[model samples]
Target: MDYFIQQLINGITLGGVYALIALGYTMVYGVIQLINFAHGEFFAAGGYMGVILLNWFIGRGYMSTHPMICIGASVVLTMGYCAFLAMGVEKIAYKPLRSASRLAVLLSALGMSIFLQNAMMLTQGVFDKPYPIELAEGSLTVGGITVSYLQVIIVVFTVVLLVGLNLLVFKTRIGMAMRATAQDKVMSSLVAISSNRIISLTFAVGAGLAAAAGIMVGFYYGSVRYDMGFVPGIKAFAAAVLGGIGNITGAMLGGLIIGMVEVFGAGYISGQYKDVFAFIILIAVLYFKPTGIMGENVDDTRV
Candidate 1:
């Protein structure tokens, strides 16, 4: 039971990160029907940006820190920069292909992914960068199971993010625009809704969330690499799909489930092939519920 609890905590932390990153994929797909394959790279980019900012700020005495202050600054800066990056990507690679076939947009996304990976490698060089956070370590015990400070932070932050997302999607004007755009772009445009702006906003939101996940991973795992986005990106994509690709709530639930499954699988089964567990779940979910847990593939409902 203790072991099970430990695995559960571990899974939740991993799941939180996955869910955060997966939100971008699901959101972009929800409205645009195109997977921004390069979305993952945005995670890596955000991490690098945060670390660089941290180093510069600290080096120049522009910032001093209590642990909380440092973390807050990193989080805010990372989110802003990533949001900008997302908007830029949408304006450049995606907006032009909005009127084109889905295949064209998808191919363009793949192109962006490749370009980013290569660009990061060329520019950042090949190395694993250290985390800027100097986190205080402690563990909280619940039901005889202990979870570390990092794990707790990951879970809490994820919950806050998901709650904020829920409010954003279900309670706001922009959310309505997003749903309207997702349901039918032509109709949305006819009604004076700027589908372009909504789509750009979607990408920006997704990028910001993914960057937050990247920040958490950087602090918890202790290193960030240029190619780090690939695995987490793929896993988060699986989470998005499992939850119901276009459903925001579904994405969140799926991420937690996937995280738990992978963690438990690694702990109890073989750590070497931990990744296979998510794919296996994905396959099973696909076979049973092709539209996803919360996804309405053919439904025309708007928020």
Candidate 2:
């Protein structure tokens, strides 16, 4: 009972992180129909940016003595840096390959991923950087189950992000432009919409969301490693596929479900097979619903 509840909370937190990462995958897929293999690196970038900025502030004694304020500052700096990095990635690795074969774009993306990871290693060194955590060490008791501040924050933030994303996609003109671009790039351009700009915007938004997840995960785990994005990337990709490759709402659903399965399966079944569990769910989803929970279309985009 209590144990189940505890694990459920853990799963939700994990899912929130994955969902955030998956949004990057889905958004990019929606526009360009290729997974940005380098998407995961943006997560690493966020972690690195946050830790470096926090340390700078701490060393300079510019912030108050409050740990939370320092953490918040670090998070904000990370988000901004990652947004820039995402836009830069669009200008460099992806823009040139947009018209190339899908396979070519995919390979290019893979190459970019490898390049960035190694570049970070060469520049930042191979050692894992630690994160500064400021949350008070305590848990809130609810319905006979204990939940930590970390879980609360993860769930809360994910909800806020999801709501904001929904509004951005459905209510705003930019979002309408995005949907139009997704529907038909040629038609969108015929209507005076810049497909190139929309694509870049999609990438930037996806990367920004992933950046938030990366920073949160770093703070939660108390460390940031250069290669830490791999597993999360795989899991988030699975979530994106499971929910529906190009469906925004589906990505959220898939991420939460994946998170729940991973956490509960590990706690109740075997920790060694947690990664396997995530993939197994993905496989099952693919097996039964070839197009995923939400169906995919010819354009690989959902308006």
Q: Largest lDDT belongs to which candidate?
A: 1
What residue pairs clash in candidate 2, if any at all? none
Pairs of residues at least 3 apart in sequence or in different chains that clash in candidate 1: none
The CA-based lDDT of model 2 is what?
Answer: 0.85
Stretches of candidate 2 exceeding 4 Å from the true structure: 65-70, 296-303
Tell me the number of clashing residue pairs for each predicted model: 0, 0
> All candidates' TM-scores?
0.93, 0.93
lDDT of 1 by residue, 1-303 (tens): 899988887888998988999899999988888788999999998878777777777776656645457668878898999899889888878989878987788888888888888888888778998976555488888778988887877789889988998899889998888989988999999999998899999999999999988888887888788999998888888899999998888888889998998998899999999999999988887788777888776444321
Cα lDDT of model 2 by residue, 11-130, tens digit: 899999999999999998888777889999998888788788878877877655666677777776777778788888887888997778877877888888888788877877799888
Q: Where does candidate 2 have its weakest 10-residue lDDT segment?
A: 294-303
Give the Cα-based TM-score of candidate 2 against the true structure. 0.93
Name the lDDT value of residue 7 in candidate 2.
90
All predictions: root-mean-square deviation over Cα? 2.7, 2.3
Model 2: how far residue 189 lies from native, Å: 0.9
